[model samples]
Target chain A: MNDQPAASGTPASGGVRIAVDAMGGDHGPAEIVPGALDHAGAHPEDQVLLIGLEAAIRAAAGTLPPNATIVPASQVIEMHEHPALALREKRDASILVASDLVRRGEADALITAGHTGAAMAAAILRIGRLPGVDRPALAVQMIRTGAPFVLLDIGANPDSTAENLAQYARMGAIFAERVLGIPEPRVALLSIGEEKGKGDLRIQRATELLDASGLRFVGNVEGKDVTGDLADVVVTDAVTGNVVLKFFEGLSTFIFDLFRDEFRRSLRGRLAYLLLRPGIARIRDVFDYEKAGGSPLLGVRGAVIITHGRAKRRMIAFGLGVAAETARTGVPALIEEALREDAARLDAAGAGAEGRAEETTLDPEDTP
Target chain B: MNDQPAASGTPASGGVRIAVDAMGGDHGPAEIVPGALDHAGAHPEDQVLLIGLEAAIRAAAGTLPPNATIVPASQVIEMHEHPALALREKRDASILVASDLVRRGEADALITAGHTGAAMAAAILRIGRLPGVDRPALAVQMIRTGAPFVLLDIGANPDSTAENLAQYARMGAIFAERVLGIPEPRVALLSIGEEKGKGDLRIQRATELLDASGLRFVGNVEGKDVTGDLADVVVTDAVTGNVVLKFFEGLSTFIFDLFRDEFRRSLRGRLAYLLLRPGIARIRDVFDYEKAGGSPLLGVRGAVIITHGRAKRRMIAFGLGVAAETARTGVPALIEEALREDAARLDAAGAGAEGRAEETTLDPEDTP
Candidate 1:
């Protein structure tokens, strides 16, 4: 594990290296091997280190590309296992081993289609969090009405304070700027309504902090605004964000299934579906989660993408590409700088607004 | 205003009567008059009492049905006007007038497509709350995959406590049973995950309360489960519920618009559209908000419906139908009885479980 010297304080360069958890996803090596091969073929300059049991990797991959290699790990974390507990118990787990490669400068980034909680746990526990960052957040890039934006804290911290929300705004804004290429991203707090005092106390306090933080604060936005281009980056506690993301995924699938069933109901419908096939395909492409790659777990020292558990070869391949691209852009370093700058600004402001800061802090008496 | 003697709470004999706020919606009397006429025409025995300026009502309605009559009000509440302030100042506003009709039993129920805030204010201030009911909730009946479910506190109470959510569960369960015909409705708390300790403290506390409330509690259901057949009644604070509802509405509209634009792009696509017209129409019918009628503001002494501000004639007619059906079934009376029973149970439990009751109470320190 310590064969290569750790890359300290500098971003990986020359060519990108991605550590993929080949045994982590629902389909295991069967899906992960092909996905890794696909990525290696498409991105000739990038290398994929497939981490899993040697026998399973060989059984699935058969013949690997020149740029792809297998790194053996004896244990695997199941989807339903408690993330932190499992990570601590199985030190040589595929996800942990993949994260270790990133930590030791053997790989530039880590990619997995495994348990989301486990992926976040491994990334934070193995690779570590950026300095001054209290918690890492999962940033998802969503498209609505042909407009793309980022939403953060999708499932990392279930109970987040106003401070965590403010930090998410900063991290999400940076991700949108560096990855999504939105200049001076407009950050919005996801609340019940657009009014300032619409949501609960946590939201109200977060709104105030965001307004005073000098970001392009766009006031409060509702769930409808997530797909309305109302903001470039939307921030919320993990609970609400996770629910919204899942709901979007479920509803999208439900609608498509309904359409498919309708098209097969009659001969006339079948003919219509044939003619409309290409157009419908294009519409599906616009909403395709696979094409969007994976959601990046931000605030970690290394780039880690937590792909959907139901992801196939296409989604897995796209996830590896995303990992390579994120590493190339040095997004983690950029996020670290942004957070430091934000913290310094808050420190200066806090000197004069101590009362406001104390008012917004999490209260112990609030716990039930 | 009192030309006819007030028919005290005897459920509007012969046929149900609905007080319509003709001047309250975006389209004013133009939309409301025809909707009233439609309802009156459909149900000959039922009566429509249209409240608005006399001239405008006559101009828009032309000739009303035999059962439809204009009950003129001198003022109207604009959609943007402050709900409580305007209701106090404009005592004769159409919304207020309609509420008065329901309160005095001139009409069995109140129907309005006006400002939602205004409508809720008028209902609570004029019609009053049911006995043992602390907060009223707006319950929306949603359909997905041809399955219907009731969601409560959609916009009535934005900041809700555990006790309030517990009450919403009871109210929503009764609504599902009486109106939606779901006997022994399964109630679920809207949360980020299905895990017991998933969301914030408020949600966790609410889960405990619901479990002990003696209903068919189905534990916690995520946002993805809303459109699924996981539960009959999904209860949440108004903020989250409103966001989910609006997002569903916006996303549905956005997807259909995409399909429409896609079909019009080329000749082949257009041909496909023609053949798929009927199938697509059927799909649209499944997600049609207008067909669902208005969401009921439960926990009030009288039946009150808050229809969408953008509702048209057909939607208004359906809303009136909902009002008549609710009155006929005595939903308000049923809700009152359920609430009294729940209150009694809580009171008995509170004596021995004072610590638990105090822990569940809304903490003042939580308010920022």
Candidate 2:
């Protein structure tokens, strides 16, 4: 998804305002309240709109700042619930209320570590896609690199269409440029291999379409390339990204599992862990998500960030920080410009195709 | 495919000889020839034969041991060629000759690092699968915890059906217990989540069959559990494993990329890399493939090892080590037990149904 530099050519507001789903996440109101309070306490310049049951929020938050207040949300979206079904049924859900605050102009952005699909659905139904956006995607930050790598449709579209993937490339480029601030960002389509004919049919069509879309396409990249900063925007359908993301997580954990095993080899080895705690901690930070918070649902008219449902208090605070940073930069405006360019290019292509059809008529068998 | 410990199976003898494909891999005959020399030097301990182009083998190996001799092969299988097509056409291919050694009763096992698919195809066509094996599978060790996690079908059958997965699960368990000495090695079907209906249709059906297979079926596991010590044997189609395997490589590289970025942040950080060299080496060790070598083509009539085509001297040595270990323990004997168990169950059920045709109903559903 997209995070912009807060101004996408919209009116500038010095103080950033964000609506956070304090009742969501594994830690619930307990972590959410603390995260909002923590962000408010640290960045007093920003306002946090806490959306959840009033009593529950106040009970966890204790004395919130004058810049923060409870906006009652009657429903709750469970992490395990289906996205579309939950969004349709849970009208006053905290995610819904949070998105509504952003839609109504009461808040600059909304943040949630609840169900990603439900959050996306709520953002789409409430905030809607930006004028040129055909589909919304989850653009996650690869914290391993100091620079961000946007992996679109992380869990949004499991089965991607060629056209949708083409759009994803364009939208992802805008997000990377306007939000992450990488000029002429390298945009790549994730595939099985770097070879031209390596992937399935969708990738085949997508490669051609993306190349013609004029969005700085960098050909096909394998999953390993995603983490190495090989490109700023590594594009793929949500299904592929989801698998890759989970695979990365598993690898990191596998590394840790290996560490524990080595640590237990003998008392002498366990001593090494104690001596090297700082170095190990530093390495851990390189892979930590707490530094970047949540993924943004790009292509939406308004800013809506979706985090993991299993997030704790620290993650919520990071999410808040991310929302504020996004609100400060007007990312929506850049997306609009990119969209207009895409439309004009498509129009010109259509005109060119029509002219070609009139001049080069031939039998199907003889054409090749 | 089939690697069971043959408690009382026929033993290989009668001047059995194997012609090693010496001029292969990244290090070529330099490593392969030495490996052949070592294997031949230990002939009395472990019986086998060696074969390659005579000139190259002699030049690289410097007078081989008495137990090994050169057998001429007209050509070699390059890593870059398509394996299936190459094996079908290249009669005097080195990998083919290695398999031919087994076919001619000159060798009991064939090993190569050229093309996995080509090596597998050559062995299957030349040595063939055991009489009852329906499909052959590749089993490899995924070094995670101190103990290795044996995974099957890394790229053997990526698009397998439910029954194919069932067969793999059985085959994998047998390999683990017989070779790795894990008693009734716990088996698991890999998927995206732990819930009953979390994965694709194949996984769901496989899960049901595994549950009833009377094997030590450990329930459904997420992607993370595959590399952990949660299950002794994890079963999946080759396509998924190939994808997952590449993703893991990417993740590890990503980790390295991040580490490099951290080290380059400042002069002080660069110093940290030097100071933390020991621990960093430990981290690197976690991702090293030296300890994890070639995947064994199980279920085939003879033991065949498929090392990575990119093998360096160390990797080739490790692959040979794995082959020696497999042969020493007689892993194929375990394959026979699992196959026999499955066949016996099917036979008993079929016999019971024959006399009670009207009373007994044929169930089309393979899994719950």
lDDT of 2 by residue, A72-160 (tens): 99889998886666776778889888877777677887898787657777777676667766667787877554776877766665445
Q: Write the per-residue lDDT of candidate 2 for residues B1-368, one digit (tens) a residue.
A: 23322221224333333445675677778777776566556554555455567778778878656666677887887877766667656778888778766665565566687766577777666666665666678888876746787777765643466678888888878668766778989888776566543455556667766776898988766666666678988887654555566677777776666556656666555665565556667867766776665788887765677887777656666666566555555555556656878778868767443221111111112111
- Second chain of candidate 1: TM-score? 0.91
Best by TM-score: 1
Q: Relative to the unseen true structure, what is the C-alpha lDDT of residue B245 in candidate 1, on a scale of 0 to 100?
A: 87
Residues A265-364 of candidate 1 have per-residue lDDT tens digits of 9998899889988889889878976876799998888778988887889989988887887888788888788888887887877656632322221121
Candidate 1: where is the Cα deviation over 4 Å? A1-10, A63-66, A104-106, A145-147, A195-197, A351-368, B1-14, B63-67, B195-197, B351-368
Task: Give the per-residue lDDT of model 1 (tens digit) for B1-368.
Answer: 12222232234445788888898777888898888789999999888899989999999898888898999899988977867668778888989888888877778888899988888878876777777777888999888765588888887875678888988999888778876688999998888778754677777778778878899998888988778889989988776788788888777777877888888989988998899888888898888878768999988777788888888999999998888877767787777777778778878787465323222211212211
